[model samples]
Target: MTIVNQLKISAVSIKGAKALEQNLLEKISKEKYKPHDLFLSLEKISNIYNVNKTTAQRALHSLVGKNYLYQIHGKGTFVAPPAVTFQVLVIADYETGTNNDFGSIFGIPAFLRGVLKKIDLEKYNYSPVMLTKKKFIEILPDIELIYRSCRGVIFFRNIDIFVKTLPVLKDKNIPSFFYGSDALLESVSNADCLVYNEGGITDLAINHLLKLSHKKISYLYIDESPTQKKRFNLFLQENKKYKFCTENDILYFKTIKELIHNNIIPDIKRLLKNGITAIICGQEEAGVYFLNKCLMAGIKIPGELSVLTISNYPICALTPVPLSAVHIPIEEDAGRCLELLIDIIEHGSKSEKHISKTTIVRRLST
Candidate 1:
């Protein structure tokens, strides 16, 4: 027999059990049980309906099969929300000429893997929506449709888009969780956030160098994102504690393109002459390039100069001198983002913001 026929045959054997199931569904639809509210157990079901345990079980299972209820393994069944579709939308930033052509340089693939690992496939469906800044406006109507269809949204590396779309999402009462730095969260009110502690990473990298008796440290950064600005500010604050490198030691390039096109060789030589013995790089790509230039200029790693990258990219491991880095916990942050989003969806409550800590991954360069 076909699956539908088998389900019908099973329902017939239970007798009057089908009526019991409909009554239960009616109560659920009438808001007798709120979303995430627990349902009766097998014993309670049988007692209340004056039916056998087998009949109660069949009735409950039938409701589950119809998506009227959901059960957690080892935990009891709960009243499913009205229109509980079990779909989550993940919106990611897209950048041209980058790994995955989107996301941060550290690796979008690893971040996505972390999210997937934490998600329960049997209970939820995951859908990803990637768009560049230019494309977002053009396809916004379609995005609205997509947003309305999903239960909640998880945003990654797309602060601009998130900010722009926040109003509409709020109007529709859709819960959203942002996976980004604390600075990014400051703009949006009432939304859940899973932040990467950019300031903490700066502290970890700078403190490690200070302990090594390296005072004259320079910092390099590319891009003007809020997260990058926060890192730069934290580096300055830490430098104040030690009276290390002066204002001149801090450098900024508007974009990675600017960093590549401009020759900063003379500037590096000047810093080296000024007793700058160590450098903290904020961007991974720019850091790798600076390391190559320093090596080519006959600068010794750690002996004459030391370098530390503020990134957790796998490429850091394969570099000529494995780069010492303040490793951002991308995987942990992604997992936390998923967990928080799900909590908001199930309980209909806004979760408090969370910040993941960073760790220093020591390697040859430091």
Candidate 2:
């Protein structure tokens, strides 16, 4: 053979051997064979790949050099310790005990479920770290350890907590993204955010009520966060265009405990007396509470009061009168955020914001 042809053939063989080495490593990782049990004779690899013994030997030697496998003096080649996996950390404002109960939390569980479903298990692993408002300060010292271990982070929390904790991740140059409505604010400009359009959700709710010819409506909420504020503000903004409700019709409570202690039923009675026909609720729990209270007061749903919730959980359907709602696409948004995070990690791309659309799900309550 000509020298040029011989050189080209030799290069092809080397490339083939390298490819075989990668395939072997992937196989070892997938099978999870013990180091001693993974030892394979040169003949075994040759037969497995249908390559010559010299090619197998070259591939095995390359793996050994890269610490993917080890060779002993007399023993055959063995798999090395598994390579460290890329970890994506998820931080959210929730207690560990409430992790499994979607009703107790907001849409966080649904969002997390979507993220878990879409993550590439072969290339990356995820660790969910729940942090409550009370425990956030306690976890500050351990932030460095978390930052060092995780390649990226996905945050779903209030603006205050996010603003406080984000600096640690930023200091380490770790890629991160915010998932939820709190990320919509100008204060959250630093991180890439996947936000549900509060305006769109509010518009959907108000438009639905308007279509139903409900003129006197009210907006109700229990908590005051940036997200809640956005929803409430959007409700007000949309009300201006529709003229369905006024500022006096808005009802808010500091907490659920306060709502009960102050007797929310009495307020509902008063709202009904004032000719309020429909209510748009910011929190799902608040929607449930209002529905129950209205029912207990012998108020006929959709006949006397039409309730609509801006939430993600399907529990709304289980109520006495299945609630109509502006359903936020929590799972889809979560998956999109994870995809964006992976893109940034793999491609060194600039972080970008995404706004997920909301749709009104018509049901008995409306």
Top lDDT prediction, candidate number: 1
Q: Model 1 misses residue 8 by how many Å?
A: 26
- Model 2 error, position 305 (Å): 1.0
TM-score of 2: 0.73
lDDT of model 1 at position 355: 73
Question: How close to the true structure is residue 240 of candidate 1, measured as C-alpha lDDT?
Answer: 81
- Give lDDT tens digits, candidate 1, residues 232-265: 5766775586666777776678887777677877
lDDT of 2 by residue, 1-366 (tens): 999998987787798898988888788778767765656788988888888877788888888887778887877677777555666666665565365444436577777788887876665555444555556556556755654456677776455666766787677677778876643456867578887766667677877888899887788876743465566566667557656556676787887556545667777777788888998887656677677777877889989889988674787888888888878788888788788888887888887777887888888988
- State model 1's lDDT: 0.74
Winner by TM-score: 2
List the candidate 1 regions with Cα displacement exceeding 4 Å. Answer: 1-85, 95-106, 123-149, 223-241
Q: Score candidate 2 by lDDT.
A: 0.73
lDDT of each: 0.74, 0.73
Q: Which ten residues in a row have the lowest lDDT in candidate 1?
A: 94-103
